[model samples]
Target chain A: MSQGRERVYINDVAPRDGLQIEKQWVATADKVRLIDGLMATGLARVEATSFVSPRAIPNLADAAEVVQGIRRVSGVGIVVLVPNVKGCERALASGVDEINLVMSASESHSRANLRMSPEQSLAQFAEIVDLAKGSGVFVNGSLSTAFGCPFDGEVPQSRVLGFIERLLELGVEGVTLADTTGMANPAQVARLCEAVMTRWSQVPFTLHVHNTRGMGLANCLAAWQSGVTQFDAALGGLGGCPFAPGATGNVCTEDLVHMFEQMGVDTGVDLAALIELSTTLPELVGHDVPGQVAKAGPADRRYPCPAGL
Target chain B: MSQGRERVYINDVAPRDGLQIEKQWVATADKVRLIDGLMATGLARVEATSFVSPRAIPNLADAAEVVQGIRRVSGVGIVVLVPNVKGCERALASGVDEINLVMSASESHSRANLRMSPEQSLAQFAEIVDLAKGSGVFVNGSLSTAFGCPFDGEVPQSRVLGFIERLLELGVEGVTLADTTGMANPAQVARLCEAVMTRWSQVPFTLHVHNTRGMGLANCLAAWQSGVTQFDAALGGLGGCPFAPGATGNVCTEDLVHMFEQMGVDTGVDLAALIELSTTLPELVGHDVPGQVAKAGPADRRYPCPAGL
Candidate 1:
C-alpha cells in the first residue's frame, strides 16, 4: 500500500459505457447534455463516447455527432473507447482527449469479447499505443474480466499481471483492471492489487467494478487499501456487459463520491450537484436509472412530508 | 490484522431491527414465519423481535407474541434488541438466548435516537447486564453511530473506544460498532476496526452497517481485514434507523454471503436459500426490498439471450 494520503480520481462513464448496453437509442444532444452535466459535478475526465462501428454497438450510433455536439467546457477531458486502429483514428478525428483500449484477461472472454487470442490482443494494443504515441491523447489499457471469467472460470493472477506488464511496456498512461463479469470479492481484489502494486508501484491503475453480486464497493475498498484510487463509474449505474449475463452497471459515481467525501477523502465532486444531474438522466435516456442514492438522496436528507407528493 | 483463516458468523436482524422501520404493520404470525425462514438459512443467531413499547414502534406491537410463537429450531440462538431493563426483562422472559443493548457513541445522535446521554446509556447498560447475568442470557453492547453520526457530524474514534471500554467493564459478551448512517469509508473503517481489535482481540465484535451512503460493504470489507468476522445483516437490506433521516438497511445477508463466497471465504450460509428468502421479503413486508443480488442472479448465470434485456 502507498504510504500517504490517497487521492481519488473519478472517471465518469455515463455517456459511452452507461448507454452502450441500453437497448433504447438516446439522442446525440442528450448524450452531450449528459457529458456536460457529469462535467459540471467537478469530474475531470468523462468517457464521452465509443469510436466503434455503429453495427457493433448500435446504442452508440451517434458517437461522432455526440462528440462534436458537446460544448468543450474547460478542465473536462473527454475520453472515448477505441477497439483498434480504425476506432483510434475515429477517436483522434473526434478531438477526444484520451482513448481507452480494452482486452479481456481471461482467454475465453478475450476470444468471445474481441474475437482474438491473447497474443493478438497484445499486438493490437501495441499497434494502437504506437498510433496514439504523439497524438496528444492519453491512453488507458483496460483488462476486462480480471478477477474471474464466465467461460474460463477463475483467472490466474499471474496472467493478469503479465498482461499489465505488457501494457505498461506499451507506454499506456494508465491501466484499468475491470471486474467485467462482477465476480470479484475483497480477497481477490486485495491479492490482485497487492501483486500489481508490488511489481509496479508507480503505475496508475483504475478500478472498473460492477454491483452484480453486491461486492462492487467491497472490492473497491480492497483496491483502495491496496493503493488503487482512480475509478470508472456510471451515473445512475446505467451500464453492464452483455457477455456477462447477470452483470449490472458500473459502480455508481455519485455513491462512490459520497462515500469518499463523507470520510474526509476529497473527491472534488459536489454530491448535491451530482444528485441534480442524476434526475436529468431519465428524461435524457428515456428510461429510469438504477442508482439508489440518486432516487433516495444522500444519507442524511430527510424524506419530505408524504402530503408534499 | 488477523493471522490465519477468519471464520465469519452471520447474525440475521430482519425480525427485530428490520420490521421496526416499515410503515406497514405485519401480523404476529407473519413475523414468526419470517423468523422461521431466516433461521432456516443456517444463521448462527437470529434477532427474534424487540420488546420495546408499542407506542414507540407500532410495527413490533406484538413483539412478545411473535417471539413466543417462533418454533425453537435446533442449533439456532435467538437474539433480541432491548432499550432498557424493562425491555431486557421482557426479552429474557421470552426465552431470548442473547440480548443486544444499543446506545449511540455520538451524544447528539444518542439524544435524538435514544433520548439519553452517552453516560446515561452506559449506566443503563451496566444495570441491564447485571440483570441479564443471572438469567444465563448473553448481552452484546452495541455503540451506534460509531463511525459517524448525522446530528453530531464526525464522531471521534476516541469516543467510540471510551464507550467500548465502559461497556466491556459491564458484563457483556462484546461490542458492535455500527456505521449508523453509513458515513464510513474504507480508511475510517480500517482505522476503527484496527483500534478496537487491538484492544479487545477476543471480544465478539460484529459490524452493523447500513447502505445509506453506499459504503456498507466497503466498511464491512475494511472491518474484515481488521479481524471482524461476525456481521449483522437484514434479509433484503430492509432496515433503517428510526431516528436517522434517510438511512437505509443493514447490509443484506444474501449480498454479504455472496461477496464472501465469491472471494473463497467460508461464511457457512447458503446464498441460493438467501435469495429465495430475499424474493419472499416483498410479499412478507408488503413492499419490494432493496437487495440487487436477489433480483439479479449470481454473476455467472447466463440468460438465454445475451443481446440486451
Candidate 2:
C-alpha cells in the first residue's frame, strides 16, 4: 500500500468559501475572530476572505475589514480568493500573503458560475498574475470542477492537465484541484492525483474536496496515498456548492486533521484547539454545521461505564 | 498500493442494529417493508432483526414478526443478532439463514453492555453453536469494541485475535470486527484488519465501523486497502452508539455502496434503489437521517445552467 507523506498541510477556508453562501450575514468582527481562531490552531494557511464583488457574495462584503482586523502570525500564510484582476488589486491592497485565482475546468460550469468560459478565465488569470508580479504575494490558481462538473458530467483528465499547465505557465506558484460539486470518487481521485503529482514533481498541489456524497475524507485518503500533502478544508464543514444547492461543502478541517493524526501522519495542526473552535460554529452560523469530531469527540476519548454496569 | 478486491459484499443492518435504539417505534409492517426494500436492492445480506429481549430494545420487540414477514429471496442471506442461547434458539426457530452472535472484545464494554465477561460470552456462544449445529443456520460472530472501547480505551489486538480463534473453534462460520463506539482510526483499522486477514486467510471477515468521528468512509477505505471485502452498514445511517449517545451510527449503507461503486468496485448492490429506500427513513423513524447521498443525490447527478447563464 502507498503510505503517503509523513507530514501534511491544511488550509482552512471557512471564512471565505464557507460563509460565502450563507443567508445570514456574518459580522466583519466575527469573521476576523474566526480567521484568527483558525490561524492560532497551527494551520498551514487560512483563506480568510474573498475579494469578489460584494453584490455577488453579500456575506463576505466586508472582506477588506476582515483581512485588516485579523492578527498576522509568522509562518502562517493568509490567503484570499480573488476572482479577477480587480479582486486581486483589492486583495493586494489588503496585504494578503496569497491570492487564489478561480476558474472551472469544465466549460459549462465556468460559464454558469464565473460568468466566463475557461479560456476567458485563463486570460483573466494571466492579468491577475501580472498585477501581483512583484508584490511579494504568492499567486495560486484553483480549478473548480476539476474532478467532474455537475453540468457537464465527466471532466477529461487531458482538459484538467492542460489547464494546470496553463496556470503554472502564467506564474501561478501553486494549484488546487477542487471537487466543486463533490463528484470525485476515491479511484478517480487517486488516478488523477497520482498523474498530476508524478508529472509536476516540483509543484505544490492541494486537494480541495466537498462531502456532497460523503466521499470527502475517502477522496482525501486516496489523494494522500497518491502523494498529496496539502489540503483545503472548512471549519465545521461549512461550505456548499451554490450550483448544487443543498449539497454539503468542503471537507471538515477538524475531521481531516483527526484522520491524518490518527494515521500517524503529521498534520502540524492542533486538533483539540480546532475542535474547540468548531464548537462555536453552530451559534455563529445560526444553525448546525456538518462537522462530526466536535459532536462525537476524538477517537481516544474515553467515556465512563454506564450507571448500572 | 493494495487494490484489494474487485468485488465487495455489503450486509445491511438497518432493521436490527439501527432501530434498536430509536425512541420512536417503527411498526412491524414498516420494518418488513424496509427489509424487503433493502433486499430488493441486491444486498448480499440483510440483518433483519435481533432476537434479544424486547424489553432491552423495545423498538425491535417485533423481531420475530419482521423476520417472518419479509420476502426471502434466493442468494441473499437473512441474518439476525442473537445475544444468547435463547436468542439463538428464537432465530433458528424463525428460519433465519444466519445467526449473528455478538460479544465485545474489551472487558468493560462486554460487562457493561452484555452483562457478562468475554469468557462468559464465549461460553454462551459455544452452547449456541451447539444448538444451531444441525439447523443449517450459518453461525457468525461479531466482536464489538474490537477496535477500541468507550470505557476501557484501546482493546489489545492479542485479545481480539485470541477471541477470534475461540469463536472460529466454536464453529462460527464468519467473524466481524466492529468499531462499536466509532473510536477506531484508519491507521489502526488498516493494521488490525491486515493482521486478522493475514492470520485467518480462509475466514470470511466483515468490517463494521461507526461514523462517530467522521472517519467512517476513510476507515472503510483503509480496511479495503488491507484486503477486507465484506462490510456491515446501516441504511440511512440509522444506528447510533448506544453507549455514546449523541454520536452517529454505522456507516450509511447507500453511501458506502456509492463510494465503492464509484471506485469501480462491484458491490452487488443497486445504488439508486438503495438511495430511494433511504429516502423513506424519515417517515419511518420520525427524524431526518444522517445520510448525505439521500439528500445531495449521487455524484453523477447533473444540474442545469442558472437562468441567466
Worst 10 residues of 2 chain A by lDDT: A240-249
Model 1, A194-233: lDDT tens digits are 8887788888888898877667777776787778878888
For residues B212-297, could you state the per-residue lDDT of candidate 1 as single tens digits?
A: 66677787777787788889888898897554444457888888887777666788777888889788888887887767678667
Please, what is the whole-model Cα lDDT of each candidate in the order they appear? 0.81, 0.91
In terms of lDDT, model 1 sits at 0.81
- A187 Cα displacement, candidate 1 (Å): 1.2
Model 1: residues >4 Å from true position, as ranges? Answer: A73-75, A115-120, A166-173, A241-247, A295-309, B241-247, B300-309
lDDT of 2 by residue, B112-157 (tens): 9999999999999999999999999999999999998989998899
User: Judged by lDDT against the true structure, how good is candidate 2?
Assistant: 0.91
Worst ten-residue run, lDDT, model 1 chain A? A300-309
- Each prediction's TM-score versus the true structure: 0.91, 0.98
Using lDDT, give the best candidate's number. Answer: 2
Q: After superposition, how far is residue A167 of candidate 2 from its true place, in Å?
A: 0.9
